[model samples]
Target: MEYTFDQAAALLNMGRNTLIRRLREEGMLGTDNLPTSRWRGRGVFRVITKMYRHPVAGYIHYGRTVITVKGLNAVSRKLRLAQHQPEGSRNRASWVN
Candidate 1:
């Protein structure tokens, strides 16, 4: 599911240059062949995969936004537990019941 600069820009609904600039600033792209200014030529860029750890979750980028696998798992476990709880059980509150 790797995406090129053009694909990523289109998917994010952002200009190609803007996406490139963000990736460059984030150190996810090499700066060697970049234009001196935004008004210059389209800079050569590549997506660099990275892993980020938040206080309560871990995330990975697949080009557009960070996906929090750990957070999803935690939420899924909670949902499953709620689904299995018996009706009128103390564990099943009004909000989750």
Candidate 2:
């Protein structure tokens, strides 16, 4: 499944512009989650564009970037792990049990 930028931001509890900026700079969308090495190394979202013609105007093209469900799930899991760990702690698995 693919989610629009706005939908992804809403799901991640962040602003759309912030999400876009993070995606460009960090290659991830979620704010609370520390992006995994895999996510930080490469961009995840893909841009899709559509062209449409209106009665009053000529053809207009618009693009929307989308994120995959798997990507969102990975971010969500990382966020949950982050929330569970104590401050300055390194043991991510400590909170699993």
Candidate 3:
């Protein structure tokens, strides 16, 4: 399905400009400002075919290490885990302090 800038931004949880930047940086989108047979309106709309890279970590599975693009869901999940678990607070208390 085709998505406008605002819709895409909301879906991706990113600023519209950031999405545009990615489209440009990655060369995943075009800026002809002209509509094609498939797309309507000017080039303001971007056509997303496939996710070349993950929205967040940008790294696919690599030897048990899931490196993702910054600001992606994976990073957010990790941050949440860290926040909940401070340090050395296992389920069972071991020996001395």
Candidate 4:
């Protein structure tokens, strides 16, 4: 099953924005707050877009990023590893698991 960002964050014991920022920093997410192509191909995340008709603006689209089970596991593991990094060791894209 997929989870909304807020739900995923809660499951991961983090705040919503923190998760998004971390994912973006890790190159798993784009500036649009959706999964990047690499991560998407890995079955990590999905963006669901809904369209609504506005009285004056016609169709309006809204996108929401959801985390798959695989994504939750990947992100949770990454966050745990990040917290246990060696002193002076920095977070890097290569270390993302």
Candidate 5:
């Protein structure tokens, strides 16, 4: 089942912000917390976009990212691996090559 970041963080025994920060540092997520193309996939995440009606704007699209069970596990494993690695190296953006 898909889980929101809050639920995933709880399951991973981490704070939501911390999880997001870690993902940012790993170049998996952008500053807005959306997954980068490299990590945005069926096994990792599902993005839901909702169109909200506005008084003057007519409609605006808002979205949220949910983690799959696989994604949660993936994140847990990545974080564990990261703990053993040195810092500064992983903070660079992982662009699509």
Candidate 6:
């Protein structure tokens, strides 16, 4: 299942803004950071956006954004690995096992 930004933030125990920044940094958001294939069948998060306009008012509202379970797991795994790493250690290969 997918999760809205707010829900994902809550699950990760971080502020929504901080979560968003992390997602963007991890290439879980935005098209600019996407690969040449454009994320199709790429096991990455795709942005689902809905534009809304009020019936009586002239205001536009953007809907909540969401990410997939896979993306969330990826984020969680990255965080776990990051937390276990020693500072200033460039030998990430050793972390695999």
lDDT (Cα atoms) of all candidates against the true structure: 0.40, 0.56, 0.38, 0.75, 0.73, 0.57
lDDT (10s digit) by residue, model 2, range 1-97: 6667687778788787766676646545444333435564344455577889988888998755576655555544644422223234455544332
Please, what are the lDDT tens digits per residue for candidate 4 over residues 1-97?
Answer: 7888898877667789998899888888899997788877777787899999999999999888888766776877766632222224355433335
> Using Cα atoms with residue i matched to residue i, what is each candidate's TM-score against the true structure?
0.32, 0.47, 0.32, 0.73, 0.76, 0.52
Off by over 4 Å in 6: 31-40, 53-64, 81-97
Candidate 2 structure lDDT: 0.56
Measure candidate 3: CA RMSD: 17.5
Candidate 4 wrongly placed segments (more than 4 Å): 81-97
lDDT of 5 at 92: 44
lDDT of 6 at 71: 59
Question: How do the residues 6-89 of candidate 3 rate in per-residue lDDT, one tens digit apiece?
Answer: 554555577867755664444434464222344233332433333346788894542111112222232224223221221354
TM-score of 4: 0.73
Q: How badly does each model clash, as a count of residue pairs?
A: 0, 0, 6, 0, 0, 0
Give me the candidate number with maximum lDDT.
4
What lDDT is obtained when candidate 5 is compared to the true structure?
A: 0.73
RMSD of each: 18.3, 9.5, 17.5, 8.8, 10.1, 9.0
Candidate 1 residue-wise lDDT, 1-97, digit = tens: 3344465455456666775676556443446423235423322222245567666765744433321222222222432322222234556453231
Clashing pairs in 3: 56-69, 56-72, 57-68, 57-69, 58-68, 58-69
Better by TM-score, candidate 6 or 2: 6
The TM-score leader among the candidates is 5
lDDT of 6: 0.57
Tens digit of per-residue lDDT, candidate 6, span 1-97: 6677787677777877887776567655563433224444655455455566788876774534565666566667755533223234557544333
lDDT of 5 by residue, 1-97 (tens): 7888887777777889998999889887888778898997656778888898999999998778888756765777778732212234456443111
